[model samples]
Target: MSRRPHQIAILGTGYVGLGTAALLAHLGHHVTGIDVDVCKIEQLQRAEIPIYEPGLEKLLLSNTSQLTWTTDFSAVQQADTIFICVGTPPSADGTPDLQFLQTAVASLAPYLGRKQQIIVNKSTVPIGTGDLVVRLLEDLAPEFDASVHYVVSNPEFLREGSALEDSLYPDRIVLGGLDTALDHMISVYAPLIEQSFTPPASAPRPERYTRPAVVRTTLQSAEMIKYAANAFLALKVSFANEIAGLCEHVGADIEEVTTGIGLDSRIGHRFLQAGLGWGGSCFGKDTQGLISAGREHAYAMPILQAAIDVNARQRQMVINKLLRHLRTMKGKRIGVLGMAFKPNTDDLRDAPAYTLIQRLAELGAVVTAHDPVAMARAEREWSHLKYSSAVNAAQVFQRADAVIIATEWDEYRQLDWEALVATMRRPLIIDSRNLLRHPLTAQVEQVGRELKGTIGAAL
Candidate 1:
């Protein structure tokens, strides 16, 4: 945290690593990014970003003077602060596989102790990973003086689509480890903690944005905070979906119910919109990781498991609605709108749309899907699902048997639904995201409403 600008090295170039590099560079820190992907590093070297994230390219390109990308580990020795941003993908049992983390740290070990270093863990890891990293550093680099290096956990809470905005203006920043290690990170995030940096025009600060607080804790507690926050958000979405199912049975409007409850100060209107269940890198992995931790302690995490169950069934809600109307999926040409897990990201990891598409294909339905950003990645990754792909939104609507709104993109909401329905073979619209405020003459089938009420309809 030198005021005159300090050199920092980031060990991964994924969303979190690259975004942190850009954010830090914006604050006048020189950042060097190291990664194993040859193509990705080459892209960065040419001022290109491999992934599709809004404003990330602009931010990185604009601050070229402060950034560097390389595949060399020797470059890390020049920086006093190094951040481990490698991936921790889940294993079969939901425990985070630390293979990538181990490799990065091992490569990093041989070069440490050359200077006074503050090594920060920015990867989403299991609760006790800090201690494990500390052990690895000592064991792998026994020749280096351990006193010159310090390990700390500084977890990131960046959401994919709005990562730039979220990082620029976050709610809080957590730094966990020994008290001695706390000051170094606190100083590192001083600009963000104080909200003193000049805002980027592309992502100006919101009028009501709050300054971030730097929360200090032990290593495991800091790690747990990352998991707990994502788990609770996942639970909230599932809770709303759970209630949406109940609303259909009780003849209540879900939007009305959610709005009513959201007015309460305690229950703010953030993740309460009833639609498809949660999907992304964080929620499922973190929740399952927490449950796996529970298993280690011999305590069954009934609530989290229930949240997961409720979320899984939400996919069925769309299927059940299709069955209720079409009676069978055999030979039907179903057009699905929106395929990404959510909008503004190409990441299809655990997307709710894929599960629905797979189910439709299994029942012998001819499916064609469209998304604003995720279509290319989806075409490459989801070819086995055997569904047709559409880049033009109108192609999805043309001669389609039915349309299911999967990913809530703003452009999907602005389509002329009345005109588009006329082109479809059957004008059935399954509004999964609670999109389309206007009704479609009883032909459009919206989820969580008008689906069930009396036992006669249930039967």
Candidate 2:
């Protein structure tokens, strides 16, 4: 059944909100991207995207006829569905601080009852928050209770670099609400659920991708799903790192071991990277939040606690490697290639590169780093450090004692490594991500590569 286009209001213009707005508008919905940040709103209005998400600018700019950017809360009055996409940063105790979510809901309460609409929580909030939202909204505006508007929990599963692609063909569209509100929610995502809409020119549908499954469950379950999923992924990476540590002593290669085990159907190869550990906004925050939430019930999660511990140790391991190569680094110049947590993004939230660089600088090492897109953001954060930010990767190796491959950017993979190594004072590389191509003539120390085998000698 074909339904008329819904007026969707996405609150907060962060990565999740912006990606959702672009995807919804492309799927024939009239989307209003709202935010409290005046500068962000003005930037969007001026055809400028504050963040670096691939295909987002092209999608929004191409489909400008169906999108609106504003700072007005009154836009909710016409919205058939309102999404709260605010950030819920982690507090000191590792629990999610929901101050942003609370404020967004408070501002949205008065605007209800213009018509019956579905208020969806797309933010990654704590479990049972759906019930809390209902009660809070009832207290704020008693007139607009469950009868006037329905509250739904729809947690986001979008990744940072691949947000648009993930939203377009999600693994699953989880809807957590009562029966009355679910039909409306289904209608809003029918194009995606049924795989009916033609693919965008920039983001094409995969060759063998089937229709995405719609998971119907209770509100609390949906919230739990998001946290559990992220935690599991973090555990997987940590597990690989732990095993890699053992592999080093047992004279086994981690890359070959992971490749052999990943061939099993039950253990498909995905997050088995034994690099400088996982980073960005989701993994650590979500894992720690789940562990903290468990503590509230007087429960202990030793597995999760260990996962977090292993991750921190990974960053420290970089320093251990540095000391092994450059003994007594009271005065040494170290070059770092790739600063962003991962490739295809400029997000530096809890990035391993930041942690590694900080440790290197504290040990009296003169640090110089290079990243394709993250230099400007990193400069603002690391201005106090005695460091130089290089525009290109080659400039970083000038008179440097050693270079660390912190991030696995594609541009770094295709670099003329032989040429770059000639400029460095010490032709040594700590390829943490295992990214450098083979057929090397320089000394390279990878995370899991056997210690005895010389990668063609002479650093």
Can you write out model 2's per-residue Cα lDDT over 1-459, one digit (the tens) per residue? 455799999999988898889989988999998899999999999999988988889999988999999999988888989999999989988999999998998888888874678999999988888998898888886458676588898888888888888999899999898977878899899888888887888889999999888988899999999999999999999999999888878888898999999999899898998989999888899999889889999999999999999999998888888899889567898998988888888888889988878888788898889998889988887676667899799998888889999998888877877788889898888888887647456577887764444354222
lDDT of 1 by residue, 272-386 (tens): 8889888888899999989998899999999999989988999998999899999999999999898878888888988999999999999999999999888888878888887
Q: What are the lDDT scores of the predictions, listed in order?
A: 0.87, 0.87
Query: In candidate 2, what residue range of length 10 has the lowest lDDT sum?
Result: 450-459
TM-score of every candidate: 0.95, 0.96
Provide the RMSD of all predictions against the true structure, rounded to 1 decimal. Answer: 3.8, 2.2
Q: What C-alpha lDDT does candidate 1 achieve relative to the native structure?
A: 0.87
Native-to-model Cα distance after best TM-score fit, residue 89 in candidate 2, in Å: 0.9
Worst 10 residues of 1 by lDDT: 450-459
